[model samples]
Target: MKKTRYYPFERNRYFYGKLLTVRDFESEQKYFNDKRRMMNRLLHGYGVLTGLQVIAVDDKSVSVEMGAAIDALGREIVVPSPMTLKLSMMDGFTNNEYAKNVYLCIAYDEKDKEPVHTVANSSVRSDEINDYNRVLESYRLFIREDAPDPASLPLAGITDQTVVIYQDAHVRVLQTTPRYVNPGQLFEMKLRFEKTLKAGRLSFSYEMASERIEAIHGATIMFQEPQEQLESEYEIKVLLRADSTVNVKGTVGVKEESAILKLDDCQLDLQEQAFGEIQIIKEPVRERLMSDFVKQSLEASLESPSEPCIYLAKICLIQMGPTYVIERVEQVPFGEYVFNSSVMYRLAHSAEYRDETAGQFVTKSKVKTLAPGRPPEFKVNYNPAMSELAFDVGIPVGGGGGIGGIVSGVVDIPIEPFTKINVSPFGKPSKSFFSGEIAHGLGEGNVLILTSLEETSVDSISDMLANGERVYGGSSDVFKGSEFEPEAPEVKIGTIAYPQKGTFRIGVKLQQPSEPFDVRVRWWAYSAETASSGSSSGGGDRLDEALSALREAASAGSDAE
Candidate 1:
């Protein structure tokens, strides 16, 4: 690189002088390009020099341009313009020797018309030891030629060049031109392919918080040969959703296949132009739990009409938010907004769970004009809106002495299950099971149940054999055991259902209850929602206080009977 340096001689006055004894004009002529005019001025007694101008500077040598000026006396004089002087030879110029110093004084002749009175001693000193070293260090290297190489001729008869493909591709983000960008400014992202890859295509995806946007700079791009060897630049523009940082994640894959070639996580830092502060902050999604208590007294009266079973039943109401609310919130392609709540029922006369409003409940109202209809069943009103119902038993299945047993069956009940199985050492083994069907009441959805058998003792055994590796199970508790297959593993069973409304059955049978075990049953329901999908029938009811009053009514009816 050609480096240039500047040295300022802050003299106010200027004059013309000529070299007295130095003889390196040939090297000096290389910079000015015209040797005739310089020599003619020297011959005419007009060559004069005063200040030094830096012409070139490098680690090896410093080239300075020496110049002359009309003296401050306001006298008009014809003199040679300053020319670049290449200073390479370094000797004892400091000792004031003529061989090393280029002394410049006004060139005078005995036959001159007017007497030229000018000092012959204005010289620019060159300290190649200290001053020149500083120039070398401070000089900015100049860029000379940067023309792009012309495209090469294609290989004869070859349609596409087969670049050798290597697995496990790694890429380095070479440069993000204009790392700090305005909200809508276009920026360039340069990625260097560190590993060779076959002819493939590159795709880009941008994520700002939870929102995902496509790269304006063509999301999908085909590879151009030889470009694989050099850094590739892609132009990207983000609008509307701007944040402190935008993650630009991408994957590269072969042109014809679905296999990914590389996964690159790149980020664009932002310099935001803040307009105002946030006025009101609210959660992206709001949730409410709506429970309906249905009195079994009505069903009992309709069925037998002899003995009435007047206990209140619990029902769950799952409904979607109003259309305007869903529209106001941002939605991603495959993203979901989930609100969850669980429902359990307890009768007033049950001793296991004492009801606070036991004796005060009323099964029949004396001032009732008409009997109210029974509450709807626990059906999922929203279709294609996924729901996951998990049943978990908190107990450690102490390692089985031998191969553990597997229990697989189905439980069919009219409503949700109310069974709790107790297999603890100190407690009585109470076997409970409940089966129910959820009439999705809509079309097109899936119900998936995933049952995983996790052994807590695995951690103890793993820690004994563990090295420096960490076991992470999505929790902060480091001592928690990782999920592992046990010698006495519990039986794993599940069923899948498609379509909106379907019947489901569940069955649980304990072989031996010596080792306390934990069981978790999860049910996933997805309901399809569209812009035209209307709200379900049973929704928008607050049930916290209503549940209490319903229990009191049932207790009062039981006491009166």
Candidate 2:
């Protein structure tokens, strides 16, 4: 926005006993008038102060209501009565391919009239004609291809003198409800026309960048001859999604007579979501192990091991074969041995024999055995008188001579068997394996163990990554689809100020042989407190006072001279 410029007031200088010529008097008058005009321009600013309503009278003319305005040079422009302007009589009203913009503006003109006498002498200036420059203010219509320039004045001597009352275009924007909205939210805009839409196919649509917004309903409306009266106003509605945040330039347009006319254009800001809440569902897990049996059994029994448990046991037995003496032999008794302990065991025994033929019989017998156990104590009951000693001992043939052989014999007997066992806890295992189990369980819809739980925050749904292959399960209300229907927005209708200062614009575009229509314009202006006090005679009273003071000063000067 550009800033308004400030102008200082020019005042006259006075001195004691100074010669006063006609030029000096004129300069004094100019000083006072310029001071007052400067105050008006500086304090109130230049624009229509009241009542300049414009109404279309016909296809080529319009009626303007009586009004008042201040020109750029601080001059008051008053229209005492209503007036009419013809479009064909205005400049730039010739036919063209496109429509032209017509502006009702204040035009400034000056004329040399109102003759007055400079001196009261009898014959000094007889038959002479002197006049004062009179300011004439009237309204004029300017037709152009575009809106009037704000930076450029209408003429060299004029500043904001060309106060535009109104301009005629095809369509004009009235109001927009909720100039901004979140994505996927609905908003509405209203538009007005200066002319009735012709009986034809009328389509309504909003034009914007793709993915920014979409029309849900009310995009098109058909107008028949009977419906032409209802075409003065239109409403456009559109929806913006929640996932999009880019600002959009939306243009609402109407199609008629094979031509598209823009009704309203505006920039809407989309409020983006700062963060989104999300709940993550984890996959299930399952595992199997040998320790599960033991653990379950122990749990059922309500028992647990306090320390490591180990046990070892061993037992062995051996027997000797029956012995016989050679030559003068006597019978020999059999013997047996047994052992049992935590370490190696040995057995040793002796047997006696007597000879009967040679009065002295010599017989000897011995037996020995060793194994992984304690040695055994032996007690024998034998008689020397008996020809042979008898005992309950049995021996097998083909037995090895040493303890190694005896131990080998027991090896085939399966004395004490050696076995190994491993124990491990159930369920706890590698993470990758657990994950695989979870995934497998998810597919089969079986009972699973939860491996992990996670959550994340994102600005929008677009920022989240989706992996279809991974298993997911849970419910979330954040991204759920809505079931209720969207509510319709309220209607809004009003006039908008034009880019050109102090003016309201109305537009219309229709097929050839367009219908006669009226333009409605609402406007406001700047005014000082005294001017806006609703006093109808205040301005006339002030003017009269100034004129009377001027006459009294002139009379005094004439008498002094």
Candidate 3:
């Protein structure tokens, strides 16, 4: 059996609070003044933080101790390490009543699950408190319904009763594991709901607006005597489509309650993952047949004796994030190579990285050139936490002089220049402007830039490499000293921003060269960490085994070749 490695796919829980309307902020004399005051209040009080605990819960009310607030006993609560708290603003909805309407999104982690304390000995009845389960069963929300004023009728009325809205059931579509999904990916869509009616039979059906998506199993589900808290699941496969909204509709029927369940407008966004940019520059070397005798001997040893030249391709993986790794690389020939063939398709070898250090990221690789006729193989090791990729490349060379039928000489070419390519993210707030010394040791070389506007996958680029076609050529933006050349340079760089993140393929093509040139680049990248629990944040025991498996795969594939 062929063993495949799987990285941990983490799904974060997202709790979106209902739109909050601060009455005073909404009724300010001036719009701009209201906005300013509201923002100041929110920042000082209701912003996102970790360790916000549930202090009290009842049928009619629920209270929370904010991360920054003091507890009832007046001692400070323990605070956990904080993550990014993204809050959505609704100032654009000016026509509405309130001056500010914002929602709170907590990227909930299961590791933060702590037993919530309930107010037990209060005067409230147990049955009514048990009915509090009704509130917990639905999409949870916490409202600070403090008396609008310390003296405002105590906000009492028929409307003041916290109404528990009831229906047949409520369904929420969720990608629990990843919180987000990529186009053309197989993902699980979990539907969590409660059976409001105890003794009713319900049938469910789902449909996606786009034809590019299909349900793995039939999309219909049936429930008999469904429990109070029940969960339904479906595996959905989606294909790449232009940025558009997809509606996942679910219809349900229940006879006893005379209720018809229609879950409409359940949106599944169709967007690509954000991938970084890659630039590849190559220095080509021409093959010299030393002598007729040498050429003849080399030809006889190999089935196909084409002059195999040495190729040195320098690649830059650029992003705003800390670091990245090259997970996999493959090479295949598109057409037959004659003795005078100008270009050879070469794919850098695959490797993995484990971010062992707390802050710094390191990249290291080893390359071994086979015989004169074969292309080299690359072995890479890197840190996964900082980033997830590294490239290893080999250049084949053989002895030129022969003494007593023994080829004698050594071609020692050092690898891992490991230059950085610093580039800005593509759009505004864009990090696209790149200025640097083209090559360190070799002095100056022309810089070529191009944009991969379309979302492309590593698999697609690997196919291009395997096909041995010229894809990175044609007109390009070139910078040589103070002068600018509109014509394409020998190499090109492609940038893919977020919503387009994927395995980026960089193709380097160089025509016949009489001498050697230098290839170099350096890059830096950063991605905000969301969840910190489990293995998502670091490189663990599986890294070594994963790399070993990769090497075994490479060896088995090479042996087959």
- Per-candidate Cα lDDT values, in order, are 0.26, 0.32, 0.26
lDDT of 3 by residue, 1-561 (tens): 111111122223335873444443343323443344333322222222233333213211223333432111111223343322211111111222221111211211113233443456235764443212211111112221111211121111111111111222222222212112223345443332322121223343333222333345543433232346422222333222222223222211112323233333232222222111111112111121123224453212221112111101111111213322211111110111121112212211111122333445456554433323344577665766665446677654442211111111111221222223333364212112222211111112211122221112345754676632222122222233423232222333332222222111223222222133332221111111101112343443444454354445434333111
Report the lDDT tens digits of candidate 1 across residue range 517-554. 44333222222231013323442132323334434533
Per-residue accuracy of model 2 over 1-561 as CA lDDT, tens digit each:
122222244455678987878788777667776666666644454555666555666544656677666655555666779877664565654444223233444443445666665555435766664545454444443444333322133121111111111123433332222223444455443332222232122333332222343445434432222333434334433432322443443333222232233323322222221111111112111121223333453222222122101100000111112311111101100000112222222222211221225344334443222222324334344556754443432232222212111111100001111132222265322110000000110111111111101122233542454421221112112223552111111111122233223222212111112123221111111112222232355565654454454445434333111
Better-scoring candidate (TM-score), 1 or 3: 3
Which model, 1 or 2, shows the larger lDDT?
Answer: 2
- Model 1 CA lDDT for position 198: 20
Q: TM-score each candidate.
A: 0.15, 0.29, 0.20
Q: How close to the true structure is residue 384 of candidate 1, measured as C-alpha lDDT? A: 25
RMSD of each: 36.9, 62.5, 35.3
Best by TM-score: 2
Off by over 4 Å in 3: 1-50, 53-205, 210-365, 378-391, 395-561
